[model samples]
Target: MMGSERSRMLYERAHGLMPGGVSSPVRASEPFPLFIKGGKGATLFDVDGNRYSDYCLAYGPLILGHAHPRVVEALRKQAGEGTLYGAPTELEVEMASLISSLYPSMPMMRFVSSGTEATMHALRLARGFTGRSKIIKIEGAFHGAHDSVLVKAGSGAATHGTPDSLGVPEEVARNTLLAPYNDLDAVERLMREQGGQIAALIVEPVLGNIGPVLPREGYLQGLRELTSRHDLLLIFDEVITGFRLAMGGAQEYYGVRPDITVLGKIAGGGLPIGIFGASEEIMSWVSPLGKVYQAGTFNGNPMSMTAGLETLRELREKGHEGLFHNGERMRKGLQNVLDDLGLGYKVQGIGPMYQLFLGREEVWDRAGAMRSDATLFKRLYQGLLHEGVYIPPSQFETCFLSTAHSQADIDRALGSYEKVLRGLRP
Candidate 1:
């Protein structure tokens, strides 16, 4: 059994200082959350000196894994020069150019500090461009923490049993429309009724927040067609799926492009960053160039640029085929374990992202994902922790596989899953 005496003490100390004893709601675990000291590659070393094979990957950012030498070295060099400059730098130009090459849909983009800022700005730009007040968001697709997208949100909001936040005014929430994932007809119906009033439709192409639920065949293409037909902008929130799914993200992977693309997580190489982009005409609507008006002090910081540039270079050289193969290996192993144990749990994932719904039902949407047994998931979480493996504590969050994860790590994780799951079988 793993010892968490130090973690318990730390949690107690943190509880008085921070809400729920954590910086983020999703990090709050029952009993107490493990206080991690450091991580190298695919392993995390907790404060209690226990090492865990990590699949959470800091909630889907560390695509190159923790403290990659290349990224770290670059950050170190950048730190020696200067961390932040109020004025623009060549790093911004280079990074944007590189990203544009990968994501052809984004001919122009603006950098921000977080995914929330990216989505928030993108929506505002959409509203400004379309002269519409309302926007449509898929159910359980977590764009960010901003008020407009909070209604029926997923991730921490859904996991904590409050999908709709209290602080958001009814008027603000009203402007945001909700549609179920993989339901093209529903979106079409909404567009018909409120097409003129709606500014855009923002969606996570893979539904990473709600269990990495995949889109049905032609679902993304259907969305593209519907939005285009309605004259509403399409925003792909690739915060979780960005570089992890493919170098070009879900847009390139699925061959369906969005009018505006919001990218974070891996795009910054584990640094705090967000980017929203569109065509030249649409992008002209932002800042001094246009009426949308988006600005940030830390936008395109040198440190984040350095790390991101290095991370991208590593990815291009290494390629994602190895990661994809590992993902398939893990998923197949998980399914085999469930089958052998006569467990009816469903495994869902794409590329290096995955999740295990705690029931027989295959989840295709928010409602379907909600059918998973959270209670059983809590047990499984504790079991995995005891076995020295770590995944996101919330059932709603997705698990990630990083390039740092090796075949040995996958096999070890599978063994831990099998052992812990076998114990949980009743």
Candidate 2:
């Protein structure tokens, strides 16, 4: 009834070719996924020619929003020169210098192709630097898809009901410890039991995968102290929060400095990029200087460098005040709608990231997040799609706001939300 004839046909053809008719598990939906033709600013044009105000933002990369003029022009210009060289370019150095200035904790860094690669290398470097085999990860904080951090992963894993993938070896899973997010006691217990055996504790300062669950007060500082006491490296996986939260990311926002930082998503300005960085001493443990041994043919590729540089330049010049203000406005508006409807659903986020956890009042950790009504969320998602507002398909995934989103877009989305919610009231 919602007019998806073209999308339905495409999905039928695709289902036989690609698994679940999607490259990513999270993109798979009930009837069919909307095939996006193109995007500009905060809107997506589907294959069926329906336009929707996009809030998923390609899973948190397009902070400046889709196809910003500056980023597009920069990429076009860079493409004429050449795409990849298999050799280092000046773009790499410039991008690295710019990022180091913003993320002061990372004086030195290496570029990778994706967040998974960055986190994989970071975990290896941590182990090499500390000469320990174990690492700790928050229960639902997704570091990457690597064997080391896949246990209890969030995002696509949580959405599809597979927290632990079947392919990861049991031996690999054993060394990776799990602690509930926002609970330092769980981390302390793990450390107390086997602190010496652990090389690092990697966390998403704001758990962006399962939910944009904000950190409790002083929770990050407590982690820093605890990690220091146990002599384990503190790695901040800021792939989702990097530039979206602030220019300096969660580390700067929370005033907690991590030993290593893994940044992606917005860092590449919607391009495929991942970066792992730290102090010179810690980074020295990586390849060409020490024996950590991480290499990629496409590391610091020029196209991603140009896009990231331009994106960061724009953010630096414009500043993030408007983004923050818009974020608060969106969250508050959503809360007000829920209040008016008398729905117990929770609105949770900080900075530019937020998620509406249907049927839950408070969600601080993965357990709480999972307790939300997924069935009701699916109904709301479909209703929103029909109303020309596109949010992430899964309730477990976070929704984002961008500089491209305007006051009108926010208000329109809120109105659509209220209408759909009222209709669903029983």
Candidate 3:
């Protein structure tokens, strides 16, 4: 109430029209949304000028944090040239080339405006490429808000997907097969039974959306083998992990390449950009060459390319050494605090992406992550926010870090976690 004037006023106005007074559900917070006036490095200042060390990191788009000088300069310079050409440009070519060089699995790439567009288009291309109707997706791994992938698993393994969201017909969902994450046996069984009709097997590789869960050792390798043996395309939804974990994203980190990698979040440098890429053999199935079609008015907006290219240039120049080191430091610091508290919780995630799970056991899949103590995580989130260290509002979402976060910010968060843990204890 003290420092939330603009946010409060805007939210009050929003309640009349918006579903939850926020553009996205995750942005909705306790009491109301926190309206930010500005951000620099790892910190955000609300309209009241109250500062916060941001661990949400704009939901993973701010890998370099707010208003990065390079990105700002690049965007400004590009604005002078033009915003959208309504056609191809050299900048788009450069960004595509950059992505291809980094991701060897991606010989050709197409740009889209959001992760949703990327995944949707990729699925279409996969269907066209394989000439198959049915596709497999892991349960609880959100590809996007799209209808085709929104299908949910049935009451039993033999049943087809039911409409997970309203308005999506059962027909679209029927073509979608659901499997549980990290369960190789389940995936293999699905492939064995439905291999002939399956178009692709799309996964998050590092399952961040339903709370941070790493791929079990050899799990990705198993997926690769299964897809290959069954002749089904493997699509990695690396929208969250791409560029955040390393230069090539989860494909680079895990060394198990996917047939098509859908990217977003970090590609925009906090603007709007998404991409899906694969080898030329597969990617050639898309339009301007083949029949599988997709297009966007702002697909390769110059501003985003300028910012994104500069951001990638920075990552390449620095080689992600500091970013990963910072993540490790945070993980070790958090583990130490949890140990000292003797709390029954496990911190899970890949580098630069993590979630504090209040579960006693390590999480393997969505079911395991859901079993974590949500009450404890909610308490933890409220506690940290009060202390000016903001984590994701939901236990199901991962907290992000950027190269912008320094030792001071990490230490501050560690201290906050210590206190929050003590308060949660009976």
Candidate 4:
């Protein structure tokens, strides 16, 4: 058995100090979570001296892989200069320019600390711009922990939502409408019924939270048409998909554009960062420019800007093409292993991100993803862990590949997977 005695002891102590013994809910696992000592390239080393081939990639931020030399060198240089200045810097301007060049829809942007902040600010901007009070969100899409978006769909389809969390007030939840993802008819009906009150329709171009569920063909285009027709803003929560999907993100990959875009995760280069942007006319309503107020002390921290700028430059110079190719190679290899084992499982996702669902049906939305067998998934998780392949503990999370992962790394991972599956089968 893996020697996780140190991890177990640490968790026992942490359990008393932190809720569920983890700063984040997803970090907590049965028994105890592995305490990682460090990571380099595509591998992670735990406190117990166990080495794992990391497929989770720190929940999709390490696109270039852990502690990449360029990112580390950039951070080192920035730390030598200063970390945070709490004022404008040339680095921030450069970073913004790079992102804008890639995503022209966002001609201007404001930086914050997390994905939650980006989505929250975007929602507020949408409301301010339209002079409306309501917003429509995908049924199971997670935009962040903010109260306004922390909602669940009601009993009936395309109904007003209820607070998905304890602290969110019912009144706040009621202003948020929920519609099933990839269901244009449901979204259309909601807009027709509540068009006057609605400010915007926010969606994840590709659903990442529920294990990489993809959009139906023409679904995003359909949303753009509907929102334009109804005179409502369209917000793409690209927090998870940004940078990871492509240089321009899901909008570029799918050939669609949103009025306002929310970004985080990979853009931060493993640092905490969030960004929301729109055209000059729309963003004119923000801060000193106009009336919609938003400000943050760490809005454009030098360290984050340095990291993000370097990461983007590296991606453009040496990683983007290889990343796409490696991702497809890994996905096809995993699918082949499943085929060889005669397992009735479905693989979902696009580009460099993928997930193995313990179900046979193609998962195009949250409902189908949830139908995956959790019990079987738990066993696979445990088996993979024993084999030194560390994927996300939850079945409802996607696995990411990085430029650092070579063909050898993928082959090793496939070998581990095959061994685990063979042991599980009769």
Candidate 5:
């Protein structure tokens, strides 16, 4: 077992100062969260001096892997020059151009400091553009922490058993409508009932928050049709999926274009950033152009722009085929291990991200994801940590892979999984 005395000590010290002993609720774990000392490639070293094969990958941002030479060099160069200007720079323009090239639906985009900010601004933009008060979001698909979208959120919110957070006004929650993911019928019904009042329907192309619940066949197409028919904006929250599934994200991978796209995670090259984009006409509503107000001090921070630009360039140069191949390798290996062990649990995901659900039945939505045994998952989580394999502490979250992860890493993970499963077997 990995000795976590130092981590425990830190958590103990942090308990009094921070809420839940961590800045992010998801970072807090049962025994205590592991305090990371440093990370390189697909590996992380904890404060306890133990090494872990990091499947969490900073929750899907380190697609190029931690501290990639290109990203590091770019950051270093930007740091030496300037970090933030509080004003537009050439780098921001280049970054925006790159994103637009990848996602043609987004002719104009504005950068922010986090996915939460991006989603919030996107919602506001939708409301401003459509002159409507209501929005529809897939239940269990977490857009961000903002009150407007917190209704029935997943991810850490799901893990903590608080799908709806406190402090969000009831009126705000009432304006947000919920539909089960992968259920076109539910969404259609909702649209029919309240189409006139809804500004947009925001959804994750794949439900990353409650594990990787993929869109049903023709579901996304149907959504596109519905939104178009109703003259409502369609927002795809691709924060977790952007640049991880493909260079153009789920829009490219699934061949469905949304009216507005919220991007973060890998787009920032593991730094803090968020982006919301739409057609030129739609984006014209934002400040400095039209009435919608949105601004940020670090909206176009140089360091973030430089890192993001380098990350996108590297991803483009390498191609997504390799990343897909790696994902397939890991999935097949994991399935083989499950089969060999006679475990009924299933693995689900697309591209370089996946989840191991503790149920044999398909997990296509929040209901199915809820069927997973949380207690079993907690045991498995601890077991994996003991084996020096680190996945997201919560089963509700998805695991990510980076370009740095090799076949050897997959094998080692599988071996550890086998050991853990065998031990847990009755």
Candidate 6:
């Protein structure tokens, strides 16, 4: 199928109820979303039989790539047993243990259905433990669509945050403090201003929502030290970087630990799963162990556990051979090719995730990231999509690479990118 009429018809029907004709606002792109049939390895097929070497990888959950045979087989087997039992299973313990072992910050964990739930509960547990109402979150850092995190730093990243959403109550957003990513001084200022009121500071160890902006040198260690000096808890939102950064996560990468850690995306293999864990002392503040109440009927569902467990097992077997360093090699090769083309661009990434920012501006933070040439980036994205290399549609979002992607796939994308940049230039 080649942009067949059926995809258009489907979008038309979807528009009647689904706002923007998509479930998530971010997924709605220029020329509308593409409807896909099925995927195998790293490739996806659309309704019109168009095929692409997908780098989006469902926004980083499919590190093993789309419909991985091992994960698919496990899902099928679990399907035969049952879907959801609503009871504890040995698989839950196994997966949680695996994650805990990888990220030492997570000594104990609770499984939930989505990253949103993982972060939402983390906020609650922090507040309950500290009896403090305020929380510090990095600006432009997305921790799900939760109200507390939906705030922007006032007058840019230097000031306290203001509500970013319409319905998020002022009282709720007031408890949320914001700072720019990669600026530890801003974090220190917030700590001095609201340390007593603040219960915890939550951040994406590596910002993924706005490409893969990494921490500036000494940024993570500074935060760790500052939080320790003050009486506040540090939280690492590792949902996107958890399993992909190494089988361990970003906290492991930086060698800086947090009081609580959030896990999602890659942890699920490809299914929907979220987890938050910490030392026994901090986790004890959660329900049953303490007054903080966090519960989900679908928590620790067997399917997510099975998916997470199997994915970890597979990665363990591979011994980090194909999962991450492969992505690094691909990124370096693509960057070198872009440099040869004399294209003004930058590759902001870590491990298996990356985003191509078409600009000369040093993207140290979100403001810098916004300086990219949107028109050129859009053209490049569409050009690649047409040439059978699928990436995230927006310049603001990061694209992911999976083990399913090959050197040939990277070569193809680099060649297409070079050609497209030249075309868009003149």
lDDT scores of the candidates, listed in order? 0.90, 0.90, 0.87, 0.89, 0.89, 0.83
For model 3, the local distance difference test gives: 0.87
What C-alpha root-mean-square deviation, in Å, does candidate 2 show against the real structure?
Answer: 2.9
Model 1: per-residue Cα lDDT over 1-426, one tens digit each:
568899999999999999999999999999888999999999999998999999999998899899999999989989999999899999999999999999999989999999999999999999999999988889889988999888885444322223388788877887888788999988898899989999999999999987799999999999999999999999999998888788999998999999999999888998999999999999999989998888889999998888889998899899999999999999999999999999989899999988889977899999998888888898899998888889999789899999999988999989999999999853
Enumerate clash totals for all models, in the order shown. Answer: 0, 0, 0, 0, 0, 3
lDDT of 4 by residue, 145-211 (tens): 9988888665752465778889888788889988889999989998999999999999999998878
lDDT ranking, high to low? 1, 2, 5, 4, 3, 6
Off by over 4 Å in 1: 153-163
Give me the displacement of residue 353 in model 1, in angstroms.
0.7
Candidate achieving higher lDDT, 2 or 3: 2
Candidate 3 — which pairs collide?
none
Which of candidates 3 and 4 reaches a greater TM-score? 4
Q: In model 1, where is the ten-residue run with the lowest total lDDT?
A: 154-163
Backbone clash tally (model 2): 0
Cα lDDT over the full model 5? 0.89
Question: Residue 376 CA error for candidate 5 (Å)?
Answer: 1.0
**Predicted candidate 2 versus true structure: per-residue lDDT over 263-300, tens digit per residue:** 99998998899999999999998889999999998899
lDDT of 3 by residue, 175-255 (tens): 888888888998899899989999999999888887878888999999999999999999999999898778998889889
Off by over 4 Å in 5: 153-163
Best by TM-score: 4
Better of 3 and 4 by lDDT: 4
lDDT of 5 by residue, 1-426 (tens): 569999999999999999989999988889789888999999999999999999999888899888999999889988999787787799988999899999999989999999999999999999999999989888889998998888874543321223288888877887888887888887788788889999999999999998898888989999999999988999999999898878889999889999999999888998999999999999999999999999989997998888899999999999888778888888788888889988988899998988889887989899899989877888899999999999998889999888899988988998999899888853
Best by lDDT: 1
